[model samples]
Each structure stands twice: as C-alpha cells, then as structure tokens.
Target chain A: DVKDCIIAYFRRSLQQGGGALSGKRALVTAGPTHEPMDPVRYIANRSSGQQGYAIANALADLGAEVTLISGPTTLRKPAGVAVQDCETALEMQALVAAMPVQDVAVCTAAVADWRPAQIVGQKIKKQSRDDVPAPLELVPNPDILADISAPSPSRPQLVIGFAAETENVEAHARAKRLRKGCDWIVANDVGENSDVMGGRENQITLITEQASEQWPRLDKNDVAQRLAALISERLSGKIDL
Target chain B: DVKDCIIAYFRRSLQQGGGALSGKRALVTAGPTHEPMDPVRYIANRSSGQQGYAIANALADLGAEVTLISGPTTLRKPAGVAVQDCETALEMQALVAAMPVQDVAVCTAAVADWRPAQIVGQKIKKQSRDDVPAPLELVPNPDILADISAPSPSRPQLVIGFAAETENVEAHARAKRLRKGCDWIVANDVGENSDVMGGRENQITLITEQASEQWPRLDKNDVAQRLAALISERLSGKIDL
Candidate 1:
C-alpha cells in the first residue's frame, strides 16, 4: 500500500511536463567514515547519516536516479535508491572516484580528515600501567570533494559540499566553498544545544557564489525536501544562477 | 499486539518463581555524552547505544524493572523499559547518583572524560587563515561508575562496567575492576575490523575477581541475554563469587 502511494505521487509529478529531476542522475554521500587505527579499532565522528539519507530519499522522490554512498549507519536503505556501504575514508574515496559522471553530487559525509599512517596487522595492545599512552601516527586523508570538484571532463554539472561548523558558520562555509572549489555549500552550526549532529531537526544556510540563504530549523526530511526543490529550480534555470 | 506479547512473555517468566531477575531492579547507561565546545559544537564519541539498549531489553524480558539512562542516539526506546535521556556525562552522573539503590547497575555509556572549561555563550567564530586552531580548555568530568561503586550504604549488589579496549583487553579489564571497585567488567576488542562500536555484533570477556570468561562473537542482544543469565546465576548463588 505504501509503495503504491509513493508511485502514484511520483506519477502525478512526472505527468506535469517533467518531474523536478527526471532523467537526472545524483550522487549523495552520507554518514561518518571510520579511519582504522588497527585491525580492531578506528577513529570515527558522530554522524548518524539521517540528513544524508533524507537527502537521498528526497532526490529520489523528485525522480532523480540517486546513488547513495553511505558509511556505517543502522538506518534502513531508502526506497528506490541504489546504496553503497563504505567503512574507512579511503573506501569512500575509491567508490566515489569510480562512479560515473553525475548531474549533481552532494557530499554530506563527515569524512575523517586523518587516518593512521600504518594500520597494525594485530590489535595494538596496552602496555604496563605506568607506561605512556601508545603513540599513533596520523596522516591527512584525500579530499574527496575537492577531487570531485576539480576541473575534469567527468566533473558533475553541480558539486555541493557540507560544512558542519561549530563557530562562524557563514564565514567558514564561504571560505570552505572557495577552498574546495565547490559550486555550493550547505553550512550548519553544530554547536552545543543545537542537537544537529544526531537530532531530528536542522537549521541550515545555503551558500552560493552570489548569496547565502538561511532556512529556519525543520525536520531533517523537510530540510531535504526543500533542498531538493532548490536543486530542481537551479537545474531547471527557474532561478538566477 | 507487540506490547501484549511482551507482557505475556514476562508474566510467564514471573510465574516460574525465579524469572532470571525476578524482583530485581536494574540501571543501564548507554550512548555517548556530548561535552559542549560552544553554543553549537560538542566533543563526543561514537557510541550507538545498541549494546546498552539490548541489555535493558534483555533484563526486562527476565522480569527486572529496568531504567535506561541514555545519551543522544537514534534508537527506538526498548519496550517496557523506563528511559531517562541525558546530554552530558555530568547529567548522567547526577541521575545515577540520585537514584535509589539498584539491584544491578551496568555502565555502558562512553562518557566524555572532559568538557570545555568555558562554554562560550555565542557560537565560536573562526579567525583568519593564518590564525591557529582554536584552543579548547577541558576539565575532567565526574566518574559515574567509580562513584556508584564506592562503598555506600545504598550501593547496588552488583556493579558492572565496560572496557572498550583496542588491545590487551583482559589486562585492562582486570585493572579497571580494581580501580573502579566494580564487581565485574565486560572487556571487548574494538580494533580496526571489529566494527564493534556501532555494529550489531560483539565479542566480550567477562572478568570477575576470581576468574575471566571469554565469549565468542555474538549479536548484541545475544550477548545481553548471556550476560543476564550469568547475573541470574550469580545472584542465585549457583556461581562462585
């Protein structure tokens, strides 16, 4: 019954000349990537993958062929979307790199910036109580978004990145857009009491080359829907670029 | 229908006189605490609350009155268990400290050891590109397990703590038991490929004063059931202390 309802909803939209993203292909990366410390331990961020999954579902609902590349999360697969599960940052990078050119690419993953330089074959054991903490060498991971946004024949028409900031949300987001050479950046404050990391609701600022638009707090799904609508407008040339 | 089934199952267990934990009261702590960085950011760990929630559900099935104190997690509340949500380690400690003595207490929370000493009232702002990374001053949080395990008139009969170790699982667990003054410690390897932090399955070593028992990798719920059974046996005087 639910499946039929969803089909009917989409059919009605498709009949109106075109669904928002009909025939468009989208690549969405969500969740937090784990950087292996050894065979048994990893460094990870607290990203529940709710926002990214919601975005994938929203894009799918608008008739986009969505490929969701996700990190470790307990969420069920979004219906009608192709899913790819990944663990470490390297795995995510490899998967994204291998994907075909897309109309749009949204990088929402909280990718770990650093990973252990050497992954120990065995578990790194704890030493005597008096001994110092084990030394771990870390190296910067590849910047997936930057690579995807690079000037290449296969670059997506539009590349969007996310910046989860603790302070100076707008300024930092603007800086990140320039630094990464991405077309747009969705910035949000994940400060204390914001409940944005793993909570249901989010407030975001959409930073474009021309301007930054702020949206009030809303449920993650609603945010995704609104973002999808904006993406549709941008792709359809309904709004000034 | 689900509630009715659960009630029926528990009722049947109660009629058997020694339902694994009949008349027992349990306290469970789960998930990762968020220590504030500023108005919008926090320092937190990756704890899904799956293990603790599973343990709470398992104990409830055995006719124990379970109270789950959880941090931020997307998990649904376990059926028939009273839940208290908390954000920081301090809040969790307060809740546990104020409770009436529990028959058994399980500390599965990955509590943040330190919190920002001065929580900025507004969102922290990023400085110039040449500026250094923000320096965060941290202060130690109260150790809930140690406080609960202290020699108090209302101390729980059994106090169990968890040691999520990357290496030397047994030795660290053994040391933890003595340092925290807890009766038992559940030690687990969370190394590179283990996927233990947010994964569904876990392998643990249960360490007591006299002996240590290693359990094969099992689903979190199965591990909880096994642990509950062990607790039941110990309380019934079937297993030596």
Candidate 2:
C-alpha cells in the first residue's frame, strides 16, 4: 500500500509546476558546422554554442527529454540530456530529419549557407608567387529550419529559429520567421564590434507573429532559463502560443 | 645573510629540471582570426584554441613571461599569463607587431590567408532565387609569422610556426619552414575523416632543419607539455637549435 501511494504521488508531481514539461520532447541544434574546402581546410562560422547549450540544459532541468545536436564546442554535455555530435551541415540536416517526433524544436546552429562545390582529396598546395590566387566555387546547403517548419504530420507544434543580424534586426527577423514558417525568431545583432558571437552576454529580440519584445542584455544561461519558463507556460495552456 | 642565501637557492634551482626557461619572454598566437565578409558575418576556420592555450600554460609553468594573443574562445585565461583578445586578422597583426622583444614566439593561430577586399557597411540581405549568389572579393592578409621570423633587431631568437596539412605533411612542413624563415614547424593532418581540427587530441610532427620527427597521437595537453620541454631544452643550450 505504501509503495503504490508513493508511485501515484510521484506520477502526479510530474504534471505540476517544476516538472510542467516532464513528458515533453525537445530538440536543439547548436554550434557552427564546418564545411570542407579541401582535405585540410574548412569554412566555418564563429558561433560558440553557449546559447544553445544553455537552452538544452534548461529544458533538461525541467524534465523534458532533450536531444542536443551540436557541432564542436568545449562545453561538457548536460547530465540528463542526450547528445549527437556532427561536423557538416549535411550531417546535421540528416540527423535532425531522422529524429523522432518532438513537441518543440530550436534551430540555433549557425549553419554555413554555402560549402565548397568540390573538396580536394589532398592538401591544396601553395602556388608560385607569379600565379593567381585559387578560386573557390560554392554551393548552397540544405535549409534545415525551413524544411522542418514546413506543414507536415510530423512537424513540431512549436519551431524556433535564430536570426543573427547587423542591421534592421526586427524587420529581418520577422521576415525570416514568415519565410521559414517558424513560430518564433530570436534576433541578435552581431556587427563588427558588437562582441556577441562568442561573448558571454547577449541582447535579444523575441519576434513572434503578434509582437516583438526586446530583452535586456543578460548572461546566456539566464536567457535560456527565461525561454524555458516561457515554453513551459505556453505548453501548459497558460499562455497563447 | 638571509637574503643572499635565498637568492643563491633560487639561482641553483633555476638550473635544474623545472623552470629551465626562467627569465625568458614568450609570445604565442592562438585560435582562428575572423575575416569580415559583411558587417554581420565573417570567414573563420575550425580552430578551437585548445592547443594554443595548453602551450601557453605549459610555457608559463616554466617561468617564462608569456603574452597570448587570442581570437574568440570560450576557454578561461590561464593564470599568471597576459592575454590580448583580437577579432579580425588586421587587429591581430597590429597587436603582434607592437609587442616587445621576445626570446621565443609560437604562431599556432590559423590566421585566414585571405580577407574580403571590401566589407559591406550594412547587412547583406538575401536576394530572390533567380539572383546570383554574392561574390566575396579577396585580398591576402599580412604574414605575421614570416614577418616576425625575418632577420630584424626585434625578431625572436627561436620562431615556430604550424603547418596544418592533410597529405605530404613532412614535405609541406619543411617547405613552409624554409619559406617562412622560421626555426621550427609543427605539422598536423586535418583530413576529412581525421577529426583533428577541433577535436581534443592531436597528432603532430616536429620539423626542424636537422630532421623531421613524427610523434604518436596524444592528448593536446600532453603534446603541449612535450613541446614546451623541447623548447626549454633548446633555449637552455642543452639541444642544438
């Protein structure tokens, strides 16, 4: 009788405040993918994966089954989360496509828009001084967020993407949200001297179909916590999505 | 009498195994320097700065006054070492040029060989599907290691550079050592399947005028310690330069 009572109490606790997202499933992508130019060299972005890692940790803390698909970063994996490491944009796209159904999807990785059309099998040697510099042809990579946000039976109910911009942050973010068919877009300015790409703190604008809210600069962890709380409230039917 | 006794003790200790590089000054460059494509985005490599940071710490342990010029990284600064943060290749070049005379210089940074000839003042928006992809003109960046290795009044006595290659590692490293006029070159392979660029462990080959020695794969920290010991031995006149 005592064991049964304890089991019932714990089951009920799972649906309450602290564990509001206990049964939910979430997928988050973070870090910068490396696109190869040659066997030795690659093209990459400057994303540090701090924001994405923090969000994954926050979701896990709320009892959500979180799968963090990340590129290379020095951060240790969260205790209760599953991690899938990838190197290129294509690899990340494939992994995301193969995942099970998710209630929430956060696409934060700075996927390279273009990759070398052809990768040299060996090291690209330096030419003589008189020769002209080599030309690198590029091709567009698959757009993961847009593909996932498309109307499909397996599409997540809520999809979030990030817009790293330098000018007209709100306008670009809103436009991206409409184009990609994502529910929300987190916009941040990473101009030449903004110090936001690999920095500890960030200032973001949360743009949705109804409103655009500017948030004060805060540590990446705090941002993740706030976002997690909002997601919990919305998923619990306390706030309109 | 007490002060004299203490001075004599420390002088004797300096000649032993540890602290063999006492009173030496070192300058190290690490991480990938960003080259702007537009105000919003940049061109970067996959270097994580782990190797360079480890080398800096190892050198500092040997009682060398170290100055580390680094690009964006999430790692904390090593204790007792001075760090100068930089964003773009130009910024890094200027800072390295202005540093005081050093006895040893290690160029571990994967500096972008080319930067955008002209940076767009505003954000570069995506155009319609029919529009051609944007063209990013390129210009070569200043060769920091070669400049430092040139025979000059302020040149470091022992200059080292890194050659990240995928094939013909020894040949390329030797050629680079000769062309850059550097005393030593540390070569490593970052092939498509090597998983070495941003990974924790590394395999390196130390190339000098006398010989090329291949080292077994090891953790990045251990590699740094071994390299530091070799540097100390060479600088202390225990090994030929």
Candidate 3:
C-alpha cells in the first residue's frame, strides 16, 4: 500500500515537472539476517522486505539503476530492479564489498548484531528447568553500514543507514550517523505504532546538517519517492525540490 | 521479520526473567495517509507496517497488552495483538483519542503533509501540457504526533517520534523532538544504502536527556525487542505495568 501510494505521488510529481532521478545507481539491503544457533534455531527478524523493495522500485521508477541486496523476505519483487540475496551480516558485507561504488546506497537490511560463535554441528536438546538456559556464545557482527561508508575503496557518494530506536530515538539515530559515519540517517521510533517494518505507511522526519524537515505522515513508498526525488534534486542542483 | 525477531527476543527474555513489561499498554501508528485527490487518485507512501507491527508484537511478548493502530499494511496480523486500522491522519487521530492513556506511544506513521483542498468527485482528464503544470490546491494536514504527544488530557506517559534525515541527520532529529514536543526522537540517515523504510536491519543511538546509547546494526525485530525491554525498564514502578 505504501509503495502504491508512493508510486502514485511519484507519477503525479513527475507529471508536475518534479526532478527526474535518472542516471543514478543505487544499492539497497533489506530483511533480517539469520544467524544460526544450530540448524533448528537462528537469529532473525520480522522484516518482509517491504521498505527496501519499495525503495528499489521507486528508484527504478525515477530512471535510476537499482540493485536490492536482501535477506530472506516474502514480498513480491518490484518491476525492473536487480536483487541480490544474502543471509548473514558477513555475507552482506561481502556483497557490498564486491560492488562498485554507486551514486547512493541504502542499508535497510536488519543484520544480526551477534551470531553464534559456532554453528553447532548438532541441535542442542532441551533439558530440565534445573538446567540453566542454553548458552550459545555470541560474537559481534561486522558493521555493514559503517564499513561501506568508511574511508575505503568502494565508498559511495551517498551512504545511508537506518536508525530504529525506542527512547531517545533522535539522539540515538544521530549518534549512529556519526559513529557509523554515514551521510544521512532515517530515524524512526519503533516504540509502539510504527508502520515501518511490514506495514504500508510510515511517519518520518528527514534530518540534514542544516535543518530537520519533518514531513507529515505518508506511505513508505511516498517517503522513498520523495527521498529519491530529493536525491535527484541534490544531484541536479535543485534546492529542496 | 522485525516482528518475528522481536517476538523471539521477547519470548527468550520472558523465559529468562519474570516481571518484565508485565502490565503495560502501548499504542502505535504506521503507514501513509490517503489524501484524496479523487476516487482514482490519493496521496500515500511506501510504508509497510513492519516496524510498528514488530514493536507491538515485541511489547506483547514482554507481557504488555498492545493496542496497535495501524494504517494500511499487507502483512498478516501479529498474533495476540489488538489492531485498529485507519487510512488518514484524521482517522488515526480519532482512534488514538478513543483509547485510554497508554504507558508509551510511538508515532511512526508518515502522515501526509498536505491533502488536496478538495477531493474531486470525478477523475480529471489529462489536460494539455500547458494545463499539466497547473498547480493543484493544497491544504495542511493535522500533526497527529504532536497533537497526541502534547501535554493534553490524553497524552501518554512516554511519547516518541521519528526523524529521517539526509544531512545533519542527528542535529535535525534532535531539534525535531523539541519542535514536535515528544519525550524522545529516533533519527537516522536514509541516504544511500540506508534502508530505513522497508528494509530489515537498523542501527541507531539512543539519545536521552542524561545520556546516549549507540547500538550496533541489528534486526528491526531485535531493535523492537530491545526497545520494549528498555521501555519496560524505564516505566518500571511508574505505571501499572
């Protein structure tokens, strides 16, 4: 629904002489990484690739070449977009590392923070309550967003990261930009009623160095298109288009 | 994927400890509003109720009776959650108004910035290119996040908003928290490679009045679970839950 709404707005704006986001290349990642705790258990999320898929579709609509790197998802593929499939954060990093630098990169995938130290050749059996909780050692995963945005050989012109927070959402998201060293951040409160993950609409504020532009709530597709259009504007010397 | 991750994390945490989020109520909004131009055309976005739905499911796993006020979404409803569906910002406002005060409220829906001054009853033809550039009448929509979070009779105990920034992401998001009048704000860069919309992973910092916490990239579900756990901690002994 968000995607359809965004497409609607995009079509309308383009019809109204809005900037065309043509001749740009973008890379996006979506869904949650499944870090295995044996074959039976793994660490993953509930993401359905709705946002990333929508963005890829929107970017393509703007005449940009879009490549979507996704974890597992159930959503249908958008028309005329390339999709790269991955699982773990490490795998995502490998894929991103392999890609040539592009005009923009959107990291929407929810990579697992910690993975089991060992895949565990066999699934551990359940024991009595007296037995302590099964402990699978965790090791920190690579920071995919930071790594790509870092001073490196494949640094994209524009690198973005998602900051999903609860308390102190903005502060945390902003800090993440600096810490992760990304160009922009899309911070949303995942506290209660966020339509971000698998829903069709979303409410967000666009933060930049000079000002914060808080848009009224709209569909995620619209948000993506507006953002893409803005990206087009930035590339085309348009101010706040 | 975010919802599943949150639920998995919550179930694990619940098994590990008692009295975590035992009696809290959370309200959230997601997706885009439909600002009608006509029956054929309406304003909306690319949001896919992933984050909001995940948050609610996570909160429920932590023993909270969650009331999710979602906009349009394509994903199946999360188990054991009370869901309210809405289309416009005004509809969401009415729903939030009808509910009892919640312990925490996170407004993540992207409400439309403006709606057509009037929804034309019939679809207009594609007039000449000269007429194509004609500007459509516009009107400002309600600020639902601010309206509910403001110090009013129905304000929730904790309120949070989202900021999606391109440049100066954190600075802008922080300012938005003040401007929008919410207890906390989550800001992140949605620039290149940052999938804040429909992607699965997120990394954010938690900015509070006294301190900040930078979390590594994690699944949106993990993000939700962590937030629910943290919210429960912060609201401990303060609310009935």
Interface RMSD of the candidates, in order: 6.4, 3.2, 24.3
Candidate lDDT values, in order: 0.82, 0.83, 0.69
Between 1 and 3, whose TM-score is larger? Answer: 1
Candidate 3 local lDDT, residue A90: 88
Strongest candidate by TM-score: 2
Better of 1 and 3 by lDDT: 1
What TM-score, computed on C-alpha atoms, does each candidate reach? 0.77, 0.82, 0.48
Worst 10 residues of 3 chain B by lDDT: B125-134
Docking class of 1: incorrect
lDDT of candidate 2?
A: 0.83
lDDT tens per residue, model 2, B152-182: 9999989999988877778888999998899
Candidate 3 chain A lDDT trough over 10 residues, lowest sum: A123-132
lDDT of candidate model 1 versus the reference: 0.82
Ranking by DockQ: 2, 1, 3
Question: Which 10 consecutive residues of model 2 chain A have the lowest summed lDDT?
Answer: A126-135
TM-score: the better of candidates 2 and 3: 2
For the predicted complex of model 2, DockQ is 0.33
Per-residue alpha-carbon lDDT of model 3 for A1-241, expressed as tens digits? 6875676565445433533755567898888787765533354544566777778777777777678898867777665567788877889889988887788898878776556677764433222212333333556678788788888766877787876654566776667777778878877655445655567876676665555666777888888887777777776677632
lDDT per residue for candidate 2 within A1-241, as digits (tens), equals 5654564455345535458688898999999888876654576777889899999878876778789999867676665567899989999999999999999999999887777778778766655322334556667788888888999999998899998898888888999999889999999988767898889988999998888899999999999999988888877789885
Q: What is the C-alpha RMSD of each candidate to the true structure, in Å?
A: 4.9, 5.9, 21.5
